[model samples]
Target: MSWLLDESHLADLSRGATLLGTGGGGDPYIGRLLVAEAIKEHGPITVLDPDEVDDDLFVIPTAMMGAPTVMVEKIPRGTEPVLALRTLEAHLGRTAQATMPIECGGLNSMIPLLVAARAGLPIIDADGMGRAFPELQMETFSVYGVHASPMVVAGDRHETVIVDTGDDDVRMERLSRACAIQFGGAALIAEYAMTGADVKRVAIPRTLSLGIGAGRAIREAREEHRDPFAALAEFFAGTIYQNVRPLFRGKVSDVERRTVGGFTRGGCTVAGFDGGELELRFQNEHLLALRDGEPVCVVPDLICVLDDTSAEPITTESLRYGQRVVVLGISTPPIMRTPEALAVFGPAAFGLEQPFVPVEELVSERFSEPVAV
Candidate 1:
């Protein structure tokens, strides 16, 4: 059923999206503020459940593309996403009936709301990735063979650039990232303009609800004086997210970071109170995780680091030495574990020289057989 989006929903969505971000997607704070401002100016946004969308309605998936750290310095003009959407619609010769997130994490999760509220369109409760990935092509849409061409890129300093990269999603990502650099490290994008039927078939279903539920679960746990991380694990039990488990709890012992080619790349070491240590590597998002030098988790799966006491997520850009943290991992969706999907987002794709192992397989003692959705 379709529902209304209000500030409370945005708050939970921000929190849940941050956790689901898997230590990337940029902070949700700025996006949340933009969304709140848009709502106040234009009134509540109508959020359409994916199933209720008309099959022929044109849905535009949108997000901010570039370095998350850079975005903090260059605030959006608020018109960028709307402009990108309109540009894409013009390029496609059709008007968008709705807006949807490319991923349900951080800025990308809330960006579609800004577009929806400004454009007077309903936002869909779905996304390409149930969680976030650093690369644009690493999504369910591409896994299902959706063409990511004919995208629109817009920013405060550049003319809107329309892209048509044929069947190469990777090339499209390269072109978009370059545009982000030219536009001063971040740009708003509207891409994968598809019919509603296409979205229903390829998008991760009800991810918005999943994020909201996660946020609410965490908040409610805090209110009731319970363990928030425990609440998160329990809540994921009934969601499409599978085999959720806390991987490690430690204090940051080291960080090696740099910004290269408009992306944040680095690794951090967390030393447990028990004297062991875990390592996490990232390129914009947490991609590889190791427990005492053994490969414990890899990409396509999720590796989320959170505040030890508050359960707030720590994105790669914000990770620093001396912060107490909890590391959690969850199995990627079954659809994302196929051979084709793995080829795009597996550990090898990240240039890591290790075999891709499912999080469930890596730590079977921490996971049960996932319930069929």
Candidate 2:
């Protein structure tokens, strides 16, 4: 069931889905220009593939939770996930045969192709974090216990909220981050109501064909200039953060935000590659990757920052002051090595004191470098 997929493979599936959006899948170039302007005004969008859905169908995953700097200053009015999946299919009386993707990184994988081309529905290509994580029960759907509040949410005007709660997924992420801070931060949910065989048993399979083969091998290694990170390490096998530290890339001299308990925490400080001074901390993503005080990196892994050179994904609330970032790290999210994702984003859940270390064995055995592109 392939309704559509051709705008040059959604620009190589938004460049390998923005490298698994490990930098906190937020900046996918305005969600790949809103999935190429909703596939050039809703033209192509069939793409179903989780074995064509049907094992009793009724899938449902959608996304865009909140704060990639308020999703580029609140842009999505695009009928909020088809009005939160048709108001959760009229409160679940049946009618959801397809439409998936909860994560594949950055702009939550072109927001299910602009919410399945403006909610005409039929975008089942699998997701649920084949990459990209900041929260929302960090993929693998609450590590199998799955259940994110009877779920349904559709804002940007149409207004809807479902959330059949029982105080699960932490009271459904505190009532979906307080309705994404009252829809000023972002919302559009449409969550976990699986079926298609439990959405292929907690997704992550064929994640949109691995975001179209990591967005067609980094757009054919940048049109043959070659070396799009060695063609994404020939489609990464995993565990490869070989000692990466770029606490400084000259600019962003500073940045800091705070939202507290509800979580928004932030920090930034770039200067210049190794002259001195460097600091990075974030909560909406990028946990810790210091240098002037030690601890090269920490968190459940991943510390990304990019955009230092069109690498993209920069959002510590739209970091500023020059803006040339680099920070990187990859390795984490196997359910963050369990123990309940290391008790919520390991290293003492960001209060850090030293414990977890798996940014690909802390970058191939403590920062090694030399594999540059």
Candidate 3:
């Protein structure tokens, strides 16, 4: 189904994206403001269902690249995403029929909406990554053989650089990361240009709506004094991410983070109120969560952190000592857990010695049943 995205839905969409982001994908608040501004100037964006698109329609995915922490300090000029889209279109000598997110998390989710409104292009309700990952090569599109090059990166100052690495997604990541670092640690990107048929084959469908729906559920639950976490779990039960559990409840004890090589890499320890400890390691996005040194959740599955009281997601960039949070383990879609997808973004891909394990299996084997929300 098609729907219109305007200011009314922005808050919910941003909130849900933040949770799906699993601590990265840039800041949702910043992305929200950018989308608000774009909508104000250009009107609401039309979100077309992936199945509704023509097989030959050209779709371009747009997103921000670099450390989430840097994006907090370095705001975009609101023109970069559209500029990146146009530059990519110019390179291909074909206009984009629609814009879509490369990842349905944080700023990238909103970036395509901003681009669509500004460019007068309808946006697709799909994405390359059902959840965000730190590198460009981690996308399902790449996993399914979509090349990342002939990509364009646009700086806040209107500088645009085109990267063409043939089918080398890793090289595309390296060159784009270099360009982003040179652009002051962040830039807008347009890559993985695909046809509607390619989108139908590889793109995770309706994730934008899923994020928005999750956010709405949380918001309405809070408003009615209901348990938002329970509402969250209930909402996901009907979705692809069916297993949602709060793995730990604690106060952050320590944080060690640094922005390096266009990425924010680090870890934090959360001391459980009942005495155990949960340690989280991240590379832009939260990749792993350990409860008393045992793996509770690992990537490909989402490891999200939400404020214990308010249920708002806390991004990696926003993690600070002493904040009370609930670490959540949500299973990834079956599509994202396949061997091909795992090879691109599994624990081994991130240099972890542990193998890829489903969050549901890990939760069942390592811990007692999750506490009632």
Candidate 4:
């Protein structure tokens, strides 16, 4: 079913996207403002369920690529995403039937809303990843063999680059990252153009609804003074997530952030009230979470660091010392947990020496429900 997305649901959308962002997808504030303004000008945007898309319809996924920190400093010209999409369409000699987000992360999630509204096309309610990952090649589309090329990277200054890497997803990412840095640290990517059939085959379906529901659950809990974390967990309990539990709750004891290799790389230590500690590693998105030097959670799964009191998500770039937080461990969607998917984005892929372990297994006692093996 298709539905109208107007100002009424924007808050839930923002909150939900942030939750799925898994600690880094840029802040949703900028994107929300952009989207609201666009809707004001363009009327309410229609969101199509992935199932509603016809097999041959063109669907272009859109995202803002590069350092999230830099994006905040150099605000978009508001034309970047539409330019990227139109440029891609001009290259392919076809018009996009709809737009999709590469992932349901914070900023990326809302970027597509503006694009779809401006283009007068519906936005798909699905995404490549159920949560966010740091790299272009980490999306479920890439894992399922969708080429990243025929991609368009549009800069804030109105410059655009069309990439035709001919099957090298990593090289496409490298070139795009370099261009984004050269363009002053931010660029909008409209890529992975594909038919609806491919989307149905590879995409993590219904994530928009997932985000909306999660956000609503959290908001209602807060409004009712119920345990927001428990409400959030309960929401996930009905989803495909294998585990939805807090890994740890603590005050940040230390943080080290650095811009390296065109990526935000850093780690933080959180001191538990009982004197225990948890450490998190990241390259833009939270990748690993450990307790006392032992691996409790690793990438390809989600390790969301959220505000302990309000349950608001805390992205990697925003981590600061002394802030109380609850680290959430959520299993990746079933598509991302498969053997083939694991080979591309599992623990080893991120330089971790250990094998990928399900978050449920890692925190057996936290979840009352039977954890999927």
TM-score of each: 0.96, 0.33, 0.97, 0.96
Q: Give the distance in Å from residue 221's predicted Cα in candidate 1 to where it truly belongs.
A: 0.7
Q: Candidate 3: what lDDT?
A: 0.90
Q: After superposition on all CA atoms, what RMSD does each candidate show versus the true structure?
A: 3.0, 17.3, 1.6, 2.3
Output the TM-score of candidate 3: 0.97
Candidate 1 runs further than 4 Å off: 365-373
- Put down candidate 1 lDDT per residue, 25-128, tens digits, no spaces: 88888989999999999999998899878999889888998887887668898889999999888888889999999998878888999999999999999998
Q: In TM-score terms, which candidate is top?
A: 3
- Specify the highest-lDDT model's number: 3
Clashing pairs in 1: none
Model 3, range 1-373, lDDT digits (tens) per residue? 7888899999999999999999999887877898898899999999999998999999988999989999878988889999999999999999999999999988888888889989999999989889989999999999998888889999988999999999999999999999999999999999999999999999998999989988998899999998788888889988988888778999999999999898999999999998899999999999999899999899989999999988999999999999999888999998899999999999999999878888888875222344522
lDDT of each: 0.86, 0.66, 0.90, 0.85
Ranking by lDDT: 3, 1, 4, 2
What TM-score number comes out for model 4?
A: 0.96
Number of backbone clashes in candidate 2: 12
What digit string (tens of lDDT, one per residue) describes model 4 on residues 1-373?
8888898788988898887887778888888999999999999988888887899988999989877777666779788999999999999999998999998987888899989888898999999878877788777898898888889999877899998888888789888988888888879999999899998998998888888888898899999998787888788888877468678888999999988766788899999976789999988888889988888888878898889889988888888888999888887778998888887778777887878888888877553453211
Q: Residue 36's C-alpha lDDT in candidate 3?
A: 93
What's the lDDT of the predicted structure labeled candidate 2?
A: 0.66
